[model samples]
Target: MGLTAEKRSADWLAQGGLRPTRQRLALAGLLVGDGEDRHVTAEGLFAAASDAGEKVSLATVYNTLRAFCEAGLMSEVVVDGSKSYFDTRMDDHPHFFWEDSATLTDAPKDELKITGLPMAPDGTEIAKVDVVIRLRRK
Candidate 1:
């Protein structure tokens, strides 16, 4: 990664109240260093880290992802009960899941319209709505 990207990653972690540890910096560089959003699974990130010569275990990747989500740096989009994708974009938006390829991408917000939603049960209010549109080729 370029020096500027590395500096941006460090700043981002600090803004999220996360320390810029070596592993965190490495992973952050991969995620947002390019100034482009990304959707990545834990396995995918682990592979990328391995290819980048970072000595991080799959469990560490998972834990780091969880921490990122907790810190509001990333959002977890669960496509199914078995798998989830971490999104670098924190905005409230829907996503499109390619079933065949097991990949996720942002759906067009302008094309989506949520007219109504059912009332939540007592003692709880709606936090956020996550829409995942699954797609598959014929």
Candidate 2:
């Protein structure tokens, strides 16, 4: 896409309260218009930026992702506690992660339903729930 397209996307994001800096805009453009979903870690996003000719440091990517999450432009997925993966989809849904390839894909909502949990601890209720169904080639 051209700079105009980039600027337009930035404008849409800015309307959502995100200050789309150049790096942020570049990252935004990458995360969208690809015809597929994305699940990128900080390192993954950094490499992608470089490949896309977007000059950005790893730290900058990390910070920008945090800002994007805060601005509601992206969703942070933490399937593992050690590292977090950024997801662009904001809708409520589940995921299917391929363990062999470490690829994350969306799981159709109708395919599953989780309910009837025992209960939360005293004085605590469900804050947020994430379900990632892992898969491997059999």
TM-score: which candidate is best? 1
Clashes of 1: 0
What would the per-residue lDDT of candidate 2 be over residues 57-131, giving only the tens digit for each residue? 999999988988888777887866766888888888898888898878889988888877768999999867888
Clashing residue pairs in all predictions, respectively, total 0, 0
Model 2 ranges with Cα > 4 A deviation: 1-4, 33-36
- lDDT for each of the candidates? 0.92, 0.80
lDDT of 1: 0.92
lDDT of 1 at 39: 100
**Candidate 1: residue 109 Cα off by (Å):** 0.8
Positional deviation of residue 132's Cα in model 1 after best superposition, in angstroms:
0.4
Model 2: weakest 10-residue lDDT segment is: 1-10
What is model 2's C-alpha RMSD? 2.7
In candidate 1, what residue range of length 10 has the lowest lDDT sum?
A: 1-10
Measured against the true structure, the TM-scores of the candidates, in listed sequence, are 0.96, 0.86
